[model samples]
Target chain A: MQGGVIALVAEAAGAEALGAARGLDGNAFVVTDLQIAYLALGRIGPVVTSARVLGTGPDGRAGAVVELRDAGAGDRLMTVVNVSGVPAAVLAGSTR
Target chain B: MTSDHPVDRRTHVSDYFRLERWELPSDGGDERPSSFGGRAPIDDHQRGAGGGLRTGGLLTNLDTLGGFTSGLAALPRWIVTTSLLATVSELDHVGPLRFRADVVRRGRSSVVTALDVVDEGAADRHVAAATMTCAILDPRAMVLDFARPFSLAMPPPQADPVRPEEFFCIEPGAGPVTRLRLADQLRNPWGILHGGAVAMLADEAACRAAAAHGADASGPNGLAAADAVLHYLRPVKVGPVEARCQVLGTRAGRTSVRVAIHDVGAEDRMVTLGSVTVLAV
Candidate 1:
């Protein structure tokens, strides 16, 4: 579940970043990597994640870091994730 | 906790963990290329006083299994672990955890492997889900030659392996600093200290640093490392690697720490950067 959340955050952030680039022709970004450190368990209702783009590589890969906090748990840090993504078309055997 | 388990003292981390690899079906091409599956025991050596597999132990398992899967995906070209991420949902685990690894992506310069672990003794309860990213590089002459559908036999367990702290010879230094010797037993196939070893050191450093920051072990909020994210920028080919930890801050009983691992023998160059979170257990 945490992994899926991370990928969703990474893909959303990467799409926004890649959407700004001119030459790519609207390609969807796929999460390439995600490194996460689980801090505490989320014993609350909703877990929120905020992401900041670390940087974008020359080869169209974008890196970002995400932090997940449990809102019901006094916004305590739940996990920290480092994620990267590349255009779906760039993946091997991708028809896109 | 007593180290009563007789230490066999293996040379390599893989041997110490008794990681055994088995072949996976070559279905699901790029997305799920049934890469590698294996299993290892989580005995007293790998467990903490809390009776759960330590955070470092969990990271080590992720690193080891993911490394093999990604390395094999890279084939003739070797690979180096650039990043490792794992979220462990379950803490108390039964012995002999099983691992399933698959290729998520095989790109031009990198390979990403996704791994899932389950407790074999606990009726295959989910233990962790992790991903490893490796930078594909020219192997030169250090390429691994393995037959198709490669399988490695589990080394006979003579006795319980030494704990990571003892195996790595980790000792506390001044303040939040921890020292790890780059002994041959800690090195990987590339003749460098394994990434798992680095993660273990970082985890240890984070816990110690949190303790230094008033995270009382006997307090209402006892501290232990819950999660760690490591980015391997360079390899440690020299000895006396130091993990210098700095407490980022504490929030709601959780402390964040940044650890910079440097190879003192290599002119104190930073080899890995780690972010660890210590939580009240």
Candidate 2:
């Protein structure tokens, strides 16, 4: 559960899908589009969420890569590479 | 640099005040029609506002969406707004909704994508999740000044329109209430996420179904949803769940889709069910 939380933090901090996620408005954390497949149930562990800005679209759609894994004392519960999110600035900027 | 042509046509906006200058047409008002060939059916069992998950934070500070620029530095702002603009709930009873996204496939003129959202730490529950594919927008074609005199139609989103993955497809192949989630986020203090949230999810799934219908059938005749009409079963408390989405078919250029968000544990039970009809433009 926290794995998803960590991933979201990266997104709010200006991280794209790779770096983080997009916000719905005001450049914070926007969940424009999303799809998640439940691989396994929530498990306690040091889930490591790392993101990197993959690329930016000419229209302001930036992509990022997010990798989540339970880095605690257990097996890798979930390995999801979500390719989603629209930059908050993309929408907020238009308001200018 | 600033909001000029070419450079301003599709570059990042450095200021918030400048973004608001792109006034949205007030004529259409907030009531966007749900039908093209026909109007979307308004359900009778729908739950009125004041319950369920809400859009929360983002609705209050929509300007934040403008600050972001797609990875492509030269894209226009409106394109970003329609194709990539996202929202989440944060800091309140339904506090802290976070969003994430990325592009999976890129076409010469469009792009395929996906994304996810979670509680910012409120109640410590991953309430909802979703995936989407938005196309790249061109600044040359769409102008804020030109859009100034527009109605409500914010130009059809220029998407890859092609399915990047079979999973992302929302085209329903079964019954009207397929792939409905059993559990969802139940933190809408502002009553923004309940019925409205249901409508949003249903619309999204229906849109996917519409796109698939358009691609598969190919033609001005293919059917897509003119609007997604949802009847709220109830404002059931969402206790962490994923709904199932099913695509129906395209009829008269209107693609109809159905989805039910229910409890993750009780897949058999239903929370909300509805269908969307997208017209093939």
Q: Rate the local accuracy (lDDT) of all candidates.
A: 0.71, 0.34
Worst lDDT run of 10 residues, candidate 2 chain B, spans B33-42
Worst 10 residues of 1 chain B by lDDT: B1-10
Task: Write the residue-wise lDDT of candidate 1 on B1-281 in tens digits.
Answer: 13556433222576666788887857766444557888888767777644567777778767877887787777778788998776554556776888888776677898777677778898886666666789998888774767867787876674756677887678855469999977766777777888889988987888888888776466453566755678899999987999999998764444778999999999999999878877666
Q: Write the per-residue lDDT of candidate 2 for residues B22-96, one digit (tens) a residue.
A: 222224453321111101111112111212122211221121222121223223322222222222211112433
Candidate 1, residue B135: lDDT: 90
RMSD of each: 14.0, 21.4
Predicted complex 1: DockQ: 0.06
Q: What is the lDDT of residue B70 in candidate 2?
A: 22
lDDT of 2: 0.34
TM-score of each: 0.70, 0.26
Classify candidate 1 by CAPRI docking class.
incorrect
Clashes of each: 1, 105
